[model samples]
Target: MTEILLLNGEPLHTVTPQLLRATSYAHFSSLQVRDGKVDGLDLHFERLDRSTRELFGRSLEAAQIRAVLQAGLAHTDGNASFRLTVLDTDLLLRIEPPIAPSTTPVRLQPIQHQRALPHLKHTGTFDLIYFGRRAQEAGYDDAVFHTAAGEISEASIWNICFARGPEIVFPAAPILNGIRQQVLQRGLAAYETSPVLVSELASFDAAYLTNSIDPALPVAAIGEVTYAPHPESVRTIAAAYASQAAQPI
Candidate 1:
């Protein structure tokens, strides 16, 4: 489906080259809205605010951002995905059909690269799409990115988490702290944060991917290392994430 773009919550069909180029300097948050409610809505706004301050040296009010998102949500129906971008004083919203969360497992190809300013959700479409395409061409569903130092960071579009018996371990490397990942971390009991290394994939019993649209997607393999997709630990983490309450936009 084609996306609907809105500037300051108003319908926008034509974009100037200047504004298009502005996307490179923008900070964005990808989120899912269901029936006008979004899980981790506050966290999403907080992320935008933090990124905006760090990247553009500007402060963003959560209430104002919520108003803008609410207006954009009015143009869509049911479950929809929104990419809210802040370019200086302007707010751009891209509304599109929601991605169906997969119950099926997926394989990941490791890529030796790290994101600049790993904490902010800045535009890295080129790197993500390019590396992701390379992975898909290699017969993998997605790509997992790591530092040249051999630290496993995150996936192209999701945060990677590992299941180790009774606990869940998140990669402590610098990466985009996804809203869904935050929700799971806060909701789950047996969760720990640690640096994950490429050589350590075999040490974990299971693995999964988490993001705004997907609550939890099991990982079948990472290169040659295989994992049990639907482990009990993964199920527990997924259930914990699912139990989070949705906040109004």
Candidate 2:
């Protein structure tokens, strides 16, 4: 799949050195666009606007954002992984090949670290990248982050959730409230948010991770506590997410 980059609705043929030297102080949101529609489209927009306001002290124009996205999609087959990034006041859209949801379970290494501003999906990802690479080096799929107090916050680029029988529990910690997580919470009837500690992992029956790319992928293990692969729970969560109505771009 070809990757395309657009800045403020204009296609870029080349990247100048100045563009590469820009500060990494930006916030962004990513979503999978299938058939020219997105499940949590409004949520993505809201996240981008809110983060821009918080980071730059101003709000992004929704109409302008929509126009830019529309412009970018025009160059694709309407199926792609789209990312809208706000650097200061400039809007940048990156279009890449769409990713299919993963069914393979993942093993995570618990790392005691928290992001600086956990709420916004900002561009400062050095910590997550470093820890995730360390986890992979340690024979783990990815890194699951916990606070200094040992409360499970989130994983690298994803939010972690636990399954207790028929109920789904999201960690009530300072982390990015992911768009896919929010959509699942609203779609599911039995769910709650609470502080999840690493000590409590043994009590949960199953676990999964959520992000824009995949709605639910079974977590095989976290540290030493291993979870039996629960395909039913994964299907339930995926069904709930699939039930949501997609909005056209």
| Winning model by lDDT | 2
How far in Å is the alpha carbon of 13 misplaced in model 2?
1.5
Off by over 4 Å in 1: none
Q: If scored against the real structure, what TM-score would every candidate get?
A: 0.95, 0.96
- Candidate 2, residues 134-161, lDDT tens digits: the string is 9999999999999888899999999989
Q: How much does candidate 2 score in TM-score?
A: 0.96
Query: Alpha-carbon error at 187 in model 1, in Å?
Result: 0.5
lDDT of 1 by residue, 132-216 (tens): 9999999999999988888899999899999888688999888988999999988997678988999989999898899987788
**Model 2, poorest ten-residue lDDT window?**
16-25
Off by over 4 Å in 2: none
RMSD in angstroms between candidate 1 and the native structure over all alpha carbons: 1.5
**Residue 48 local lDDT, model 1:** 86
Candidate 1 residue pairs in clash (backbone atoms < 3 Å): none
